[model samples]
Target: MLVSEVMLQQTPVTRVLPIWQEWMDRWPTPAALAAEPAGEAVRAWGRLGYPRRALRLYAAAAAITADHDGVVPDSFDGLLTLPGVGTYTAAAVAAFAYGRRATVVDTNIRRVQARVISGSALPAPTLSAAEMRLAAALLPEEGAQSAKWNAAVMELGALVCTARAPKCGNCPIRSECAWLAAGQPAPSYVAKGQPWAGTDRQVRGAVMGVLRATRMPIQRELFFAPVPELGDDGLDGTTFSESLRSQLRRLHSLMAPESQLERAIEGLLQDGLAQSREGGLLLPD
Candidate 1:
């Protein structure tokens, strides 16, 4: 439950399914993962977007193995002390895993609360104090029932009361929904989309991809080399280095400007997902 909660954060269930299954298959227990190099965990993360989560999970596993005898802590406060476990994650693990009555207010749950109780299209960007209080108040006094309710409300938001194109007709609480009662209004604030094509995240993924694909460290220049422009006539099929050209072209599509690439690499290093060695880059050791 702890691993699933961590992986499900900002990541879709479809993408996480196979990876999570493989991960559990490989490391069925915290002690198993704790015994492996942290780099292996990052390598196994396999394009989940946030590679730092892998490092944090590795750290958490080690902590659990060393400090808690390989058992995930059942209490929210104790889970919060683990690396990468925040308020939502701690509450989620406590409620979902241990059947503790915790206020597990994830984005989905917050959205449901906003529309159903507050007559809003969306909740505030950050979890507000008032929202926290409301979530706590909504939780059932019984631990098991509160856990079940938490899962149900979150699933409702994800499936029926989605942020965009909500299936209000299919919503079980449509009749009593505050937003529906108030004549459903659009959100006052616009939600910004994360830039990808030309952003640092794309470049970071490219860099990590190269690192993960190769066994030895690759030179910085080759990793960030600019794509050579091809004329409208296109490449000659008779060229001797056609395969090499194709590889470079593919690499070029992934490459960002030198400065952006360097910044992205530095960020990865700071996040402990990548390492800089002698003039080359590699995954963390």
Candidate 2:
């Protein structure tokens, strides 16, 4: 449950399903993961956008093994102390894993609350104290029931009260919805979409891909090669230099600027996801 919650942060359930299953099959316990290199976790993470979560999960596993005797912490506060485990994750693990009553207010739940209780098309960009209070108030007094309600409300928002096009007709409480009662006002704030192509994230993913594809360290020159103006036709593996240059050019064109690439590499190193060794880059040991 903890691993799924962590993986599902920004990624959709469909994307996380196979990866989560594979991860569990590989490392069934925190101790199993802790015994492996942190890089293994990053490699196992595959294309799950936000690779930092992999490193954090590795660190969390090590902490659990060393401090908590390889057992996942049950209490919210205890779970919070784990690396990468934030308020929402801690609360989610507590409620879902241990059957504790937690105010689990994800984006879906927030949207559901906004439309059903506050009469808004969308929630505030950030969670407000009032929203937290309302979420806590809405949770059932009984622990088991509140946990079920938490999941149901989140599902309701995801399936029916979606941010883009809400299916009010299928909504169970559509008639009683505050937004419906108020004639469904448009959102006051304009939500900005995140840029993908040509962004640092794309570049970082490309870099990580190169690292994951090979066990040996990649040369620094290959990492910084500029994008070629034209495609290489005679770039055969027999000519090592030309082939490497051509490959690097292809990678460079897909990546961000050299400075951004360097920054991304540095960030990965700082986050313990990658290592610098002998003028080459490698996944951490």
lDDT of 1 by residue, 1-285 (tens): 888888988999999999899999999999999999888998899888788899999999999999999999999999999998999999999998899999998999999999999999999988899999999999889999999999999999999999889999988999999999998998979988777788888878777776766545556766565564432222333222444344445557865678887898889889888887866788877
lDDT of 2 by residue, 1-285 (tens): 989999999899999999999999999999999999988999999888899899999999999999999999999899999999998899899999999988898999999999999899999999999999999999999989988998999999888899999999888998899998998899989999899887777777777877876666777666775555324421222223453444455567775677888887887788787898877898988
Reference-based TM-score of each model:
0.90, 0.91
Q: Cα deviation of 5 in candidate 1 (Å)?
A: 0.9
Q: Each model's number of backbone clashes? A: 0, 0
Relative to the true structure, how large is the alpha-carbon lDDT of every model? 0.85, 0.85
lDDT for predicted candidate 1 compared with the true structure = 0.85
Please report the candidate that would top TM-score against the real structure: 2
